[model samples]
Target: MKNAELVVIPSPGVGHLISTVEISKLLLNRDHRLSITVLIMKLPIDSGVDGYINSLSATATPRLRFVDLHLPQGDSASQPQDPSSKSKSPLSFFANFMDRHKAPVRNVVAELTRSDSSSRLAGFIIDMFCTAMIDVANEFGVPTYAFFTSGAAFLGLKLHLQSLSDDHHQDITELKNTETELRIPSFTNPVPVRVLPSVVADKAGGSTMVITHARRLRETKGIMVNTFMELESYAVEYFLNSDKTPPIFPVGPILNLSDGGDDIRTKQSRPIMEWLDHQPPSSVVFLCFGSMGCFEEDQVKEIAQALENSGHRFLWSLRRPPSKEKNKMQLPSDYENPSEVLPEGFLERTTEVGKVIGWAPQVAVLSHPATGGFVSHCGWNSTLESVWCGVPMATWPLYAEQQMNAFEMVTELEIAVEIKMDYFKGFHGDEDKKPEILSADLIEGGIRRLMMGGESEIRKKVKEMREKSRVAMAEGGSSYNTIGRLIEEVMNSIA
Candidate 1:
């Protein structure tokens, strides 16, 4: 048996866990005698991630297991001792929240390393944000590779800033005091202060600490990202050229991790897919905001009206309406009826046209033949899934790296149309137009463009990129070959 063991400290988020699972699966499929253990604050169970992992594990063959590590009670969620929490200021409230989990991260690593079974440990795959693992890996004398859950473009920014903290701490402090664009080394493209990743931009102390710790990644054996070379050629080239950074392995377009079986169908997912089956090819629009996205009641109502007004076949994922009781989140008045989140008489009016669900199997929806275009928040995973499925996007970037991903998709890749823009910045300039936020008129225009409006060229481009992503993931293509190489390297490497 080709023996190797991996310890992954995945941040407790669906996207991060999904990526970690994929890397572990790739390792196991390569025939390595692997003991893959995942450490987390809480395993998603019930309606959360635990259910998803359980579903995946039931079918997994062997050499793979999801391990749950319990940390101090405060490591997860701490119960508020009393109702006086209402009196606390927002900043202090958040600080207390973040403080609780800080210790558990370090504690988990120390506990894991000291375990008797860890003798066979070959390396550790730590999420880039979990910088403490660098110390743990160093103590165990094993190679450490950072797994960036996000894209290469974002990683490029994080790692570049990290390098600045490492070599030119003085310069960074000086630059931060004034409002100036921090020119990332090797990236000729300028990134504005506001456009930087949220973690790096928002936290003064934490940002510096993260970047300083991030420098340790360069000293490690390798760095792996969930993106492909062709998709991020320049960024990948820059990393490889950087003497300070380690070799980057772009083994991504990771839809395989999302894949279960060609025939796999869930009871909850069946009704939505069945409805799509009745729609014409390239005729339906798949609209979904990611898990964290939400809008004011008015905005939600406007969108519901627009989808109703579009008269197009659509499938929309609606979040459970928030409760209006005092001290509770409130849903829009229109969503008060629960079923009314669709539209007044929407299900009845569009019975032949639309399906509204709290959550849909998005990847399956995107992959369906009827799904021709997507109206989305431009999340990285959603964007990748849409491109992989060959469905074009109607970009509606809500926040964070989403805006950057939208620009890359629409401007750099020419795969989709950006229908929204920040109107505060005059759109008359040479800079690309912002995608229209999901307003009623903008939503209608976006849906029409993706369906049958004057966007055939963009749709065609998306189709071509889709095919490229497929070929890359195919039996002997770039991603396929890279995955094979990754398996061989991990299996043959020494502790």
Candidate 2:
């Protein structure tokens, strides 16, 4: 048997890195003849994946290795740039950071090829944002594959919109704030412009960056998405039939379902689990926005009021917003006193009924039998986690492609209730326009609908999808077969 090696390049964000690592594990476990080396990139802001990586490294096997592309000494690329500059968006900043590492990546690839004679360099698997690394793969005379961390539906929408822009010269940025509805093929219903990704909808540099990545995707040998065919059958079918896209592999529902290592186990895990232990099965609503999700004090107060008024057993993961300083590169931190932003005496008022904690162990919380429903920002990973655990969701999208994911969940899948589908909390450097705050009544109504009964339509649908997700990853399943096909393609790529 021929031994082959593949290199994976993931984005700096923890969410993207987690999914990317999961896929790498799947590939390694599926085929014994293959080895994977993941090239890690550092973010200008510390997103705290180092501890997770260190833990993995401590237990890593011979076939799996992690190489950190350390930032150059005294390099400004490691520091936060001017956040006040309106011209820079998050995507652009990330893209520029990745681009600066081209020389280092090339050096690593050169070393790998020179050091290994028994194991042939098969191909490169790059995150969607790291498409610029494709050029390096080309230089080494190897094929490049894109590992899309989001769903197939979002992938289709991105490619379709980019095609429209490139082939027909349509300016999608002009559709921002309009009532125009787009007939995207991936979705069953017409998608409203308001729910478009903030990067694509706005006329910022990020829109151009998104298009560049989409165009680069078309250059890959194949695209492996972190979604199964059952969850996104229409989009998968569309890609399989279309001649425009490269071979599409729906090889996931890939997730990191562990207890999130020691950091999670030691901090707040026991209390949260203890509280869930006493609640009735399917009684508590778990509200955890993504790592980057946070709101202003006024919106936080509204959420507190809604949770109090609903009277449902609840676990809320509330985070403090990042500082508004011009040059600080920071993520949302856990509030020492959540009551500072929440309603007066709210924690005291709901002592028996609810628990408010900072930085939840999301996978652990979702898998708890007491967790009846999820009120999420509709990030794809969170959506998949909820589906995998058979929990229904109340969608409240904040930014990025979350609005698109929410639309698919509510309108297409019918597995989630909607709080506000088109709510856009603009990212850093976005125009100074505050999104409309959802009222307490509106939020409470959505929570009621989400957790009303054990036999609700959405609940049933989520349970059904959860089973499908499992089957998709099982042997002889859709994702399983797709992974086999991907391995075959990788082996065949070697000249």
* The candidate that achieves the highest TM-score relative to the unseen native structure: 2
TM-score, one value per model: 0.80, 0.97
Question: What is the per-residue lDDT of model 1 for residues 1-495, given as tens digits with 9 covering 90 to 100?
Answer: 445767787765566677777777776766546667776644222224565576686567646666655545554243332323455432333344444544554465556557635336678888765655676677678788788766777777767776566666644444433456656653445555544433354344546555655676676677778777767777777887877677778877875434443233376687887888888887888888776455544666777778888888888776653332322212212232445444467678777888777656788889899887898878788888988888898887665567667766775577887666222111111112433345788778877777875448888877777787777777887777877776667666752
Report lDDT (CA) for all predictions: 0.65, 0.88
Give stretches of model 2 more than 4 Å off: 85-89, 326-328, 428-431
Model 1: lDDT equals: 0.65
Residue 215 lDDT (model 1)? 73
Query: Which pairs of residues clash in candidate 2, taking residues 3 or more apart in a chain or in different chains?
Result: none
What does the lDDT read for residue 321 in candidate 1?
Answer: 33
List clashing residue pairs in candidate 1: 44-49, 44-50, 45-50, 419-435, 419-436, 420-434, 420-435, 420-436, 421-434, 421-435
Number of backbone clashes in candidate 2: 0
CA displacement after TM-score superposition, residue 162 of candidate 2 (Å): 1.2
Per-residue C-alpha lDDT of model 2 across residues 1-495, encoded as one tens digit per residue: 578999999988678888998999999999898999999888766686787787686668889888989778866556676776767655566767888888888988899989988799998999988999999999988999999989998998889889889999998788777999988877778898888887786575667877888999999999999999999998899899999888889998999998456765566688889889999999999999888888889999999999999999999999887878755457788999898898889999999999998888899999999999999999999999999999999999988899999999999889999999988885532444877889999999999999997499889989999999999999999999999999988877663
The TM-score between candidate 1 and the true structure equals 0.80
